[model samples]
Target: MAEGRRVKRYADLIKRVVSEVIEFKLNDPNKGMVTLTRVKVSPDLRIATIYYTVLGDEKQRAKTKEVLNRSRSFIRSEIKPFITSRWLPELRFFYDETMDYAERIDSLLKSIKNDADSEEE
Candidate 1:
């Protein structure tokens, strides 16, 4: 229970700090409206995987991913002051696909509704 709480605390801190860094500190225009979806911290407190979504197509997403991955050290350094841990966890960025899944589901539902309406007509 205590370990869980500690991990949660670290995750939340990492999320907030990383979001701020990406939003204000990183000046790369290629990153394209990057939104950090969530942060997952390893139980051993060694790695923090951050899931993010970009507000563009595949090319833009790829660019953003590349930029983020290249900026890992910078991001980690930015989080250093806020982190209470002795060492910062390894930062890993991954594109979150939840938004795409939700969009597909919504489209299917709308199609089903349209079909039902057409049948009724």
Candidate 2:
């Protein structure tokens, strides 16, 4: 489904907050190389799903998630000032696995292409 203008606006707000504000403010050592990929706000704008990715192994990813979970309240507090809405949406953190899936698909496609070329030869 197409995202409405409101959702797009909220997503942009979330992106800015996460990148320019929250990333530096978070003091947790476990929060490794985190990047906010996207945000999905509910239609009513009462809740937001923040999708993020960490540049590290599985262990680091787990640590990053834990740190984010622990720091949720701090993040919300920091974000409140930037948002003009009467009610701030509850933030929910989720790992964006799309990047990993894309990488796997690309690798598989390359392998298939190589095999096809070999068969042709």
Candidate 1 lDDT over 1-121, as tens digits, reads: 9999999999999999999999999999898999999999999888999999999899999999999999999998998999998778999999999999999999999999999999999
lDDT of each: 0.94, 0.87
Global local distance difference test of model 2: 0.87
Deviation in Å, model 1, residue 89 alpha carbon: 0.5
Cα deviation at 99, candidate 2, in Å, is 1.1
Q: Per-prediction TM-score, please?
A: 0.95, 0.90
Query: CA lDDT of 110 in candidate 2?
Result: 100
Q: Candidate 1, which segments miss by more than 4 Å at Cα?
A: none
TM-score of 2: 0.90
Please identify model 2 stretches exceeding 4 Å from their true place. 1-3
State the lDDT of candidate 2 residue by residue for 1-121, as single tens digits. Answer: 4559867898789778966655779877788999999998888788889999999999999999899888888888888888887788898999999999999999999999999999999
